[model samples]
Target: MASVTDLQYVALAVPDLAAEREFFGQTWGLTEVGEEDGMVYFAAEGMPHPYVIRLRRDDERKTDLVGFSAASREDVDALFEQVKAAGAKIIAEPGPVEGLAGDYGFRFFDPDGRAMEVVTGGAQRAHRTLGKGEAIPVGISHVVFHSPNHPALVEFYQRALGFRLSDWIGDFMGFLRCNSAHHRIAVLPGPPALNHIAFDVASVDELMRGLARMHESGIHLSWGPGRHTAGDNTFCYFITPNGNAVEYTSDLEHVDEATWVPTTYQPGPNTIDQWGTGRIITGNVPHAEMTPDKGLWQVPA
Candidate 1:
């Protein structure tokens, strides 16, 4: 199976370009790599990829598309053929994007109308390490999509793109990994939209520093600065200027694949907040009325 090498970049549409740009630049501290046409790209430290986040202005705020790098040119070709053979909604044939920096690829839509791209190359990194106390993310870690049918999306990812199952948060959610680091994409049972996009930081200290930047910008944490039992990563989530959820996370556990086992965790405090500091927000909770209050299930400090 020709699998994706890693997540490349995610393009999201925001209502206000200036506000979203400000939040990502000054608040998030991500380096402005470059701009093309009308979109701006934000570069992450330590990763050779050209950009991790792409922003476009639109009247409606929502996710635009998610890009994944294929293992090679041949892999791109193979996947393109497979997608076409399966009669998926083909946006473009496998080829080089005229103005884009990367290699040849194709674009398609998932069952829920989410745009997904698979390509071999577009841009290369300049090879730089993050400085001390820097809060800028290293790269995009993962994207969680809220789908109306979790089972169908999971099957599509596993059967169509070769994403391996990492774990499950009950029957309502599924985590799928392409090249380790727990999961690159997750699916949840709800309306189709971007749940949250997580970025990798250097350490817990750096994650806190990033949180501080958000605090300085008057953006409050919507969910956590606590650990999640599933990914085993410390997370802090906040609402973006366009109202989409974004997360700063560090220390995500990786799977060996050979020895890893997927388990279904019941919806509870341990599954939601392993360290017991985060509240159940509407971001990850579809039906809040059925969830217990934060006080009832919190682990004692």
Candidate 2:
């Protein structure tokens, strides 16, 4: 089946663009790649997806788009047909993408009304192997979302995007993978909203190094500096200036697609955070509070 190969970028509209631009470029370790048509793009040092993040000014904070990459224009067209056949609302038909990272793509609204895009043939940026202790994100890791009908939404992604089930945190949360990485997307039961966006760091050492950097920079640690049972990844979660939850994670388990069996872990305090360190700080939960995304059903600019 034609499928999205990886996550490309997440576009966000924040009321305070200046603070967000500074937070991502300076503190979060993404390089400012370009600014075009009032949008600012940021790229990770270790990945070649052009820009992994796009930020724009808006009166209120909301998710603009979550983009995924297709291997070719053929796959893009195939996936577009698949999405449309699944009864998703089409935003735009596949065509040449605009702005700095020019490519062939299409946009649509997911079951929860969040805007999504799949693209191919963008200019690939030259990237180098990030050294140990660099303490920065290597690339975009995974995204988690909250849905009112989580199971149905999970089914939608699987049937439409060619995602496979990785594991489940009981019946409440489901992890889906498109590649060897355990999961590139996960779903939880709640209002239609994003939970968090995670970034891959080099290792557990880098995860700690990043914790220190975030501390020194006065960014509040919302959760973690601990391990999660599902992915076996070390995590350190923080809230961005615009209240979006972001995670710096490392050591995510890679699975063999042919042999791996999905596990349903019982939900508990230790299930989400095995190390128990994240709970040491009072009121730090596994994820942020749930609210419907304000940008739902809005066409991307």
Candidate 3:
């Protein structure tokens, strides 16, 4: 079956581009790779996806794009056909991608109107294995979104992008996996907006060291520094300078595709945070105030 093999990048537009650039490049531990057409790109030290993040200046902070990767040009075309057949609004047909990534891809809006791209054959960068205690992201782990109609959106992802269900948090949150690191996308019921983007760190030690680094840098921790029951990942959440939520996570479970069964976990304090430290220490919960995304239904630049 044609499917997206992995998450490739997230493009964001922020009102304070300089602060966002500095925050992602310096504080968040991503390497600034290149800038083109007023957009800045950042790559993780441990991944060869060319770039993992793309940022640009805008009057309002909004998600610009979420990119995924396919194994080949054939898969890209196949996925494009599936997306079109599923009735998504197409932005561009499959073709050679513009700008630095350099690949064959297509663009479209998911059911909630967020822009997405699926590509293959991009330029790969030279990356190294990040050592323990490095306190930096290896690569993007997953992205969570808030959807007004969560079940239908989950179905859209499954039908259009060939994702499989991994688990659910009761009836409210759904985890979907493309290539078995448990989940690359999860959805919750709320307004149509992004909840957070997670980046994988080396280990629990790196997660803690990152907490200390964020504290010293004066960025407030939003929720976590604890473990989650679903993916069994340790998490620490923080808001970027432009109010975009991001997470540093470790120890995400990988599943065997041949024998995995999806579990619907009962939602509770301990289920969301197994360590019981998130609420006890930070006094913040996992839920956040969500409004419809400003960038929704708008064509990307």
Q: Which segments of model 3 are wrong by more than 4 Å?
A: 287-289
Give the lDDT of residue 8 in candidate 2: 85
At residue 101, give the lDDT of candidate 3.
61
> Candidate 2, which segments miss by more than 4 Å at Cα?
none
Steric overlap count per candidate: 5, 0, 0
> Clash pairs of candidate 3?
none
> lDDT per residue, candidate 2, 10-53, as tens digits?
99999999999999999999999999889999999999989999
lDDT of each: 0.78, 0.92, 0.92
> Which one wins on lDDT?
3
Cα distance off (Å), candidate 3, residue 284:
1.9
Which should have the higher TM-score, number 1 or number 3?
A: 3
Question: Lowest lDDT 10-mer window, candidate 1?
Answer: 292-301
Candidate 1 — which residues are off by over 4 angstroms?
85-87, 280-301
- Which digits, one per residue and each the tens of the lDDT, describe model 1 over residues 1-301? 6677788888877789999998887788777888888888887877877788888887767667788888678898888876666557877878876434377888887777777788777768785778878888888899887777778888788766778899998897799999878989988876666778889888899999988888888997787778887888999888888776788999999999799999888978778688776765445432211221122211111
Reference-based lDDT, residue 221, model 1: 79
